[model samples]
Target chain A: MCLKSVEGIVLVVGDNVDTDAIVPGRYLTLTDTRELGKHALEGLDPSIPGKLKERNLIVAGRNFGCGSSREHAVLALLGAGVKAVVAESFARIFYRNAINRGLLVVEAPGVSQKVSDGDRLVIDLESGVVVLASGETLPFKPIAREVLEIIEAGGLIERLRKELQYGRG
Target chain B: MVNVAMDSLTAKILARASGRDRVEVGETVVATVDKVMIHDVTGPITLDLIDNLNARIPKPESLYIFLDHYSPSPSIPASGIHRRFRIFARTNGVINFFDVGEGVCHQVMVEGIVKPGEVVVGADSHTTTYGALAAFSTGIGSSEAAYAILTGRLWFKVPEPLYVRLDGALPSYASGKDIILSVLGILGQEGANYKALEFAGPGLRTLSMSDRLTVANMSVECGAKNAIFPLDEVTLDYVREFNTPIDLSSLSYLRTAKVESPHLTLDLSTLEPMVAKPHSPANVAPVPSVEGVSIDAAFIGSCTNGRYEDLLAAARILKGRRVSKDVRLIVTPASKRVLMRALQDGLIKMLLDAGAVVTPPSCGACFGGHLGVVGDDEVIISSSNRNFVGRMGSPKAKIYLASPVTVAASALEGCVTDPRRYLG
Candidate 1:
């Protein structure tokens, strides 16, 4: 099931946020992910990881996640406690990984300018609404009903488990 | 509003299309895997996962593994990965594994493996490069890649294919790299997000297989799932040279898969040498349009521009000259086979004699992981794809993406300049 949490807002960047930017090639050997998280966005803003520790929502422009299909990008974001990513568009691979891992990624093409850094955001996945502390409400198209169900059921693996259990029991 | 019929190739690739008209912004789709490709960098990991999952290797003949990235490198870990991949393929009875020195995976697969109407998936993003052959291919992660290797199937939401039409013959100095960058300038980085870019028009026929591959390889730069050019006789001739034994009598299968698109044309006769300025891949302009831009490093290679044709082009320019003293030029062949062929033709000696260092075939400077690191405030005009900030090295350094001719010319001048001046 999706969790509704209000984490602080973290504005990293927009437009071609490549995998190399999220987790540089040097850190590829370290599989622990926590260490990889430290370098997330170090290519752009060196202070992102520490700032991310206190933030929840990441706002960005078009093509929020592009480049390599490394899942480490998603893991690093989730590990840093980002509750949702609001972008105008996302790379296909990144979009899929976020859902499979139960990370909330909302599509708000207008969200980039509506919110700024240090702003508080309240995301309600169930309602597909993102509300800024300034009381600005950004309505995003929710994931397909069935996809939401899979995510609500705890991602693909858990959904598969439930399906198997239901079949046998 | 407009009626368009899906072509036979598209129909074959989209047989599993759920008939949904439009994929919403945040929806997840389980797309059919058209083609699955792997290379040395991540194939070993995928092979291990396939063993653990105990999944049947579906269509071993269709699955491809190419050893590119770390060919001839003394890196023990890289060699270990290659060895394990070979053992896995041999033990599993998988048929399509191109060993080191074969060629870059994208080029090898396009030249020998891919066909029209196929949906290809690779562990590398440039897999989209195959779209040039009128096939649909995209990159996937190692885990999801492992799943595909095991099950021979993966899910994808059918992406709405963007229609880009180029109609006129390209000028001699301008090449496919310029066409793609020009397209990127119009589409922007995110303009084609999650969409397949289908390139068609009379002008496409004028471009060679290598040229089309260069265009398709960088489609990912604009956030496209893939960029496709309908397969034709040019593609067949190129593939036949490599895979002589394959019964291509069934080539007619491609015709039946053709998707009908309205004619859209781009006249390239007046196009000039173009460059994608640093910090972003889509930021583009004519090379001569930006004058006096000095370069510290110049690289010529990658799956995109590391083909034999690209090397020959550079060799022609470097034959009787030397790279500028302030500039260090690095030439990497996309594959060991390319290296050997270049050596046989004395392209290697020509490049070295011209003051360029020839390195083994690998991702190398393109990914900024190793080799050809640039210093702060330095700028490089490279034949490889993508010029994003720090793509080749230090974030402080800058990269400009250009054609091999431009890179060669810039290497001689030590600044971004037109290649045509040196040609005459």
Candidate 2:
């Protein structure tokens, strides 16, 4: 359950990448996360899904996942095997969705400008530092203990089962 | 000791919901959820999660399910999704299940179910639309929605509100759409990220219920957690129409709560019609600045506009005019209630005479769901919120966000035109 280090090649995108750009409303009918993955980021660029083949991490500028409350956006990213997302910031709803889906999203200011596509990144979830291929280190705010626990438990489903079992006493 | 006095309206609502004396900004609280709404788009997925966890709804009566997105089931898969919602509603003993043609979820929720000071969470993002009624409502993802249904609680980090002061009466041509688009221009898309927009001022008395709803609905375009309008006489009057006995004095305490300093002030008198150009809601310019940008289609619908008042305004401009041959003018009401009222009032007939095609009440084309989707490289003027890439149809298509009146006026000229000229 320990999320100590996640290493992957990074996918770099610019500012204001919204949920609609992540997955359009037209594709929302598909309930399968794997089916959704094929269309991931297709709204932004038709070739984005192809680029996710080798990259497991994304570095984005400010206000990523800015529109819509659809969990499909998180499902799509996860279905595409996106291990983590490092953005300058996230819209509140998308952040909550990623956490509930057990997707690792880090808010690292200046990371988008510092990283390039295909660069390897080793993110230390416990230490809140992102190690770059250039041997540089960028720090990010650590995820809250409660939220990290939910992620470690695989998602909100497990947490809810425990809460329901304990009867909220 | 916490400073319990001088709490903002959002702080007060969160405190009450969480059963705390006071909650500070940045502090997380597990607040009791007052109302929950799920639509066809998210309902099926949420039910799946429920089944996976073997969870039963703690309070089925508090949850409302709507089948408005793919109301008639445009495709087989969509039909299956609607069927799943129906089965789930029946199995859970949910009484507030709204079937197809119920209009949009937000509009129906505002019609009666939402009350001031309650915390409402919906599966759709525009749940912020309820804040026009002074509710602390916001949107959430399906998984979290499932959790809320199972536990009747949701967690929220108290947000520091950006206070806005509005003064002066709106011009004849300008409506809430312009006012909100103007706000988005100043705040940009990310300016209000993770913060609440608390609106209050002398001008609160000037706006109608419909106008306030439009403003609150689009607050999310600027990435606000929620946009709330304090309870006022206008809202009270609207709620009273539905015969909901609401105490005016009991809610007056919220009006007295101390709000922070004004973050942005807008004079409705000086405000002109505004439009958000394609690719972003923050890419806004005045109607005059973008005038003469030819359009292939014009739409008046979605949760943003499409109210009865919105249609009446557009009908006034379109009563004698015919839609330009170059444009396809489509009008979809926000809900069946709105559509029925428009039909009974002759607004629908007037729109038809003007060559506008009126469709049933659905989300329709605003999110590119169905009907009136544009072609590649085409341009459209929409009364709906969000002009993000590929929002209406093709990613290459340009969408302009504007008032219903502007969409109507643009339908006549087949280009982006100001509503002011037609108002007279």
Candidate 3:
């Protein structure tokens, strides 16, 4: 289902938070989702995954999820209970993977600059707004229509399943 | 003036793949993939999703499953994936199931099967490597690959094209690794985001098939969706050498092919041996600039630099010299085919005589799987693409990306050193 808004504390990170750093190659063989989550971002900080509580969000710099076309990186983040990722921009493959998996990835050009680590923010996917505790709001491009439909269907797996059931997309 | 009407080679390839006269940038098209590949790392997960779809693939002949990464069965997981992939391929009638040690997915494609004017996609991002053959190839995630497996098609947003023209012949000491690292340096890591890098120019003749593949393989480092070289006599001869009894002379697209406008030219001859310092591929510099930087290990393999010529380059430097006692050297041929050829040519014996460990035909140590994993406090010089943190071993270990020549040279000295003196 498409979440109209997400309210959570942000775990801020720098630019080019690539896939290998998100989920390093050594542990890539462990295809289990929960195990991958426990080791997520171990390259950057081994403790990051444990810090991610339910509905927590990640606010990162430009080109988040850069490098590697592996969906394991996205799965790791989602498996750790990350509600959404708001970055200046995203690597194309990661963006598509996130959308297909029904994960919320927002591109807010100055989102990182506006929020510090531990800042509670309310992000509206439908309207593309990020509201900080101080009442400051950042505008972003709203989720695309077709992508919203995928999110509404609980991801591409469900969407594809529906298509197969009905005999069309 | 903006050439809004200029369609890229990527566009043309898409147009042909989709059965249309033309496809433009930003248009979504259902591209018919000429071939697709999935390795051990991602293939099992893709299989799970494919099982969900429960769609019997019609053209099983076009799909290729490679068991390269962690091959030789590093652990039970890798072995299980291998077994599953074997069963899946056999049951589905897929002919190109490359078993353990066959080679990397990219090298396997280059050895044969991949052709010009084709659209290829693989689960691995380095799938862009096949574009060296003038095919429009890009990397996609396993979800997309799963969809492609169910059907013979996948949708793509025809990316904007970035033309990178090479000028002047590179010095013999400088290999394709230097050329590509220099390109990555100039374009940072994300300069070509969501774009296709089309390589076309007179200087293209200076590179070998492996060299073109080397440059094309790392196109994803700059965030390009695809990278391609136009079909010429060099590529034609290379392709024909493997796919015998097929007439390449009858192909029309090879003769009239050309990339569109909006491009930049790079002078190849001026480039020196280069390296990308940790923890990203874009942080590139000349070898001399980073000279004397110590290393704990030297790796000479990956889809980017594990061809016969790459091993030959390293063999030239280590013919009689022993690797530094403090340094460990690991060489992995891109494929079992390359390893066998190198063995017949005595490259493997020479490396072993010099105290280097030669692993099986697999993607090892490049992404820190096994064989020569660096320590937390160590530094490494590798011919593999990508030097991201924790890419090789510990996140604390630094990786320096270089050509096989530099890797061999540095392996002997245990530090980053100029390769000119080692070159013949």
Best TM-score goes to which candidate? 2
User: Candidate 2, DockQ to 2 decimals?
Assistant: 0.86
Best by DockQ: 2
Q: In model 3, what are the clashing residue pairs, if there are any?
A: none
> How well is each residue in A24-89 modelled by candidate 1, as lDDT tens digits?
655544444576677767777778888887776788877777877666777778777777888877
Candidate 1 regions off by >4 Å?
A2-9, A149-153, A156-169, B1-12, B16-34, B40-62, B70-102, B244-253, B256-264
Residue B168 Cα positional deviation in candidate 1, in Å, after optimal superposition: 2.2
Deviation (Å) of B131 in candidate 2:
0.8
Q: Model 3, residue B317: displacement in angstroms? A: 1.4
Per-residue lDDT of model 3, residues B1-424, tens digit only: 5442356778878988899878778888888887888888877778888887787776888899998888777887778888888899989998988898899889989887888888888999899998888888888888878777767788888898888888899789988888888889989888898999888887889999889999999989989999988778888789878873345654455444343343677888888899999888999988899999989899999999999999998999999999999899999999988999999999999999999999998888887887778888899999999889888888889999999999999999989989997876
What are the clashing pairs of model 2? none
Better by lDDT, candidate 3 or 1: 3
lDDT of each: 0.74, 0.89, 0.85
Ranking by lDDT: 2, 3, 1
Each prediction's TM-score against the native?
0.89, 0.98, 0.96
lDDT of 1 by residue, B221-294 (tens): 88777777766787767767777344455445444322346423466776778889976778889887876798
Backbone collision tally, model 1: 15
Reference contacts recovered by each candidate, as fractions?
0.40, 0.87, 0.64
Model 3 segments beyond 4 Å from truth?
Answer: B1-6, B244-251, B254-262
